[model samples]
Target: MKALSESHYWATNKKKSKETDQLSPFKVLVRKEVSDHVHSWRFILLLALVLLTFFASLYISMSNIRASFSNVNDPDHAFLYLKLLSATDGSMPPFHILMSFLAPLLGITMGFDAINSEQNSGSLTRLLAQPVYRDNILLAKFYSAMLIIATLFISLTLLMIGGGLFFTGVRIESQEFLRIIGFSVLTIVYVGFYLSLSIMLSVAFRHASTSALTALGIWLFFTVFYPILVNLAIRAFLPDAAYLTQGEKLAYNELIMDIMRVAPGQLYSDGATTMLMPSIRSLGPMSMEQLSGAIPSPLPLRESLIIVWPQLTGLLAGSIAFFALSYYLFMRREIRS
Candidate 1:
């Protein structure tokens, strides 16, 4: 009886251990993906580049920040922290601008090979053969990448706040802090759009190089060539004529801005500028009546968000659409060992 009772106790302990070890397949996939990304050398290199760019811009912004505070009557007095991010010595761009260019690269780097690399290595087949659902694989990769991105931008935001406090000795106001948070979130959304796009390319293309090059091409077109194309379109649409009325000119300007904002980079820049520069009242051309009575005071955080709602919505929607398309493509594709 004593031996039987001891055996039963050991069996119960073994059952408990098995229960503890039975983690959800989704959780396991997410953990594995996160671990892989955190350990990868390419991710480390890209992270270093982003940090270098951020600190260089921050140094330039901080060094010249005093100029913004020099004028006694300057409206910038109420926004010293905001100025820390936007102010520049003209030798380099501000933090937000540099981030606008670099954030997409980080996103693309994390996701461009998310699936194809696994597929090529034959691990994807083995992974799918486990108890994991098809949806779990794609969702795991996306969520893991997003988790890393969110962690990165949040860390940067905290660092910016701390660095500003340390160097400038200026206490950040509540609204300023909120605006900085909004800017960081906007940047994450911008990066997320690229991440989704890169993931979609990875799903559609078999080779990782093809997906990487395609993502870079899209980035270049949107960042560099798209604006040029928009300018040419504006010129074609609204020719330079002396007889154009005020209303017509305003309409033309609005149309051109709408065309320009179609690019994700423009959306991000417009939103980040609005969040970081509270003095910017409108993103589009203002009529005489609308501008005549408006004061130049810095807007509250709520108003700034209202001004950038369209941009924020567009970016989020684009991210969702791209991820949805990628999910669809990945679900339908066949895999073999």
Candidate 2:
């Protein structure tokens, strides 16, 4: 009886070990990546900077919250919770604007060295020598970074909600909550675009610094130089003239906006603005006929989403495309020690 029981125990242990071996590689890689990010000094510093700016924006917004809707009769006054996010004291910009700028840096910092550093340090070869597949490495890194980004943004959103509640003694309505949730998801997608771009650069460039600099350069160009160049090009080519009719001018302005939306920053801004501001009815110049009989009241959550749907789709599609590029590059690259 003792011999039979011992053999049963050994067999059970063996089976469990096999199951563990089968499941461990991908999960272990993801956990390791997440742990490193959480413990790293660079991540710590960036998180602190984000938090500081968040608190400053929150304080400023709370201070001037009442002033944001001074007209008690205004329909927007009903959304005091949202006002906490979009309101600015003119001393500092609102939280979403600050976030739109800083979030990309956070994404870039997390992913700029994801692959190159591993390859440079001679870990990629050994990692692949294990049971883990090449695709698992790239997928684990991207998913882990995205998990961290999602957590950080969700926590920040909750903190903003709590802070607004405490400051104004107003609870968030269902529609307001949904809008905030939409904004948070939009933010994650927006940041994912940068993260994937940086990862793609990391795979394309052998050195981590090169990838980092390239990502920053792209961001700087979009944030500063790209808009200037677009303006210059428009002025030079599609110049608006006094002789142009109202329809022609409107079409020209819309054409400019469509071109500007190609920049990720503009897309994020338009989406964030539309998500946060329920009173904004249209994104582009509307004809007098289209504006006729339109109410000035705040739109429902669904209507606001409709206004920003194209922006959301664009950000999501861009992120996926960049990640796909990174995956392709990482898979085809030679792993040498």
Candidate 3:
């Protein structure tokens, strides 16, 4: 009876310990990921590259602004300053464009070997042999990549804002500041999508190089070649559609635009332009007067949200869906060689 009681107590304690371990998996994973990232040469190189690109872009923009000021007729050219201030408006920074192109490559580079490298080194078996769950490992890797990518984006954003203020001598308005933050968040979401895809590919492919190559191919297809292909496809299929009457063309164009919003980058670009540019009061089937009349006399924040809500939701939803799909595929993948 005594021995049985002892055994029961031990079993209870063991189960309690296991439960505790399972409950804290994410924290453990995050810690390990943070540690690994700190030691990675890739992380350092990526940071350096991003910083370099950002500074270079800032210099170019400043140089142009200075030239414009020098060529000004009035010593106090308020209009020239306003134009300089608005330079960073509407679209993303040029450096951000470069970063977006580079972000996937960095994500793929970081994630392509996540599982395969461990498997190759025989660390995966040993790690799995411990109390850790397979799903935890995948989640940890993803979270780590996201954390790192987000940090990089934040750093780039601060750099741009600082550079803009320093070179242009313009104080960023509250709205403009908020817009920059929104742009950064959008960028992080975009990078997150690619990171999750990379994680999925890492799990799917045995060779890290194969995963990287596949990711690069997809990135090129989506970013560089896809737009060209889309344009060609649109032109080929709708040759006469572009020449239609204004009202009919607007309806057709709206339909096409809705379909094209499937691509997050394009969607982001369109939505961002519309939001940042105060001059763009009308978009599709609505005249400026009609749009102004549709809203409250003085548009409040909520009203503005209501107007762009569809676009904001669409871009965010698409990003979430892509990441979710990647996560599902990654979790289901077998780690065995």
TM-score of each: 0.93, 0.93, 0.74
The CA lDDT of each predicted structure is: 0.90, 0.90, 0.66
lDDT of 3 by residue, 1-337 (tens): 9999999999999999998867786788788887898689987887788677666666655656665456444322332323332344224465545655666666677777877778878888788887888778877887887887888778876766776677667786665565566656766766676776777777777888888889888877777777787678778877496468767677767777766666656655654444443334434455344556453222333443455566667755755665676667766766653
Task: Tally clashes: model 3.
Answer: 0
- After superposition, the stretches of candidate 3 with alpha carbons farther than 4 Å from their true spots are 1-23, 66-93, 163-170, 239-243, 274-278, 282-312
Give per-residue lDDT, candidate 1, residue 116.
95
Q: Which ten residues in a row have the lowest lDDT in candidate 2?
A: 68-77
Q: For residues 145-176, write the lDDT of model 1, one tens digit per residue.
A: 99999999899889988998998788889999
Model 1 accuracy (lDDT, Cα): 0.90
lDDT for 192 in candidate 1 is 96
Order of the predicted models by lDDT, top scorer first? 2, 1, 3
Candidate 1 displacement at residue 318 in angstroms: 0.5
- Per-residue error at 27 for model 1, in Å? 1.2
Checking candidate 3 for backbone clashes, the offending pairs are: none
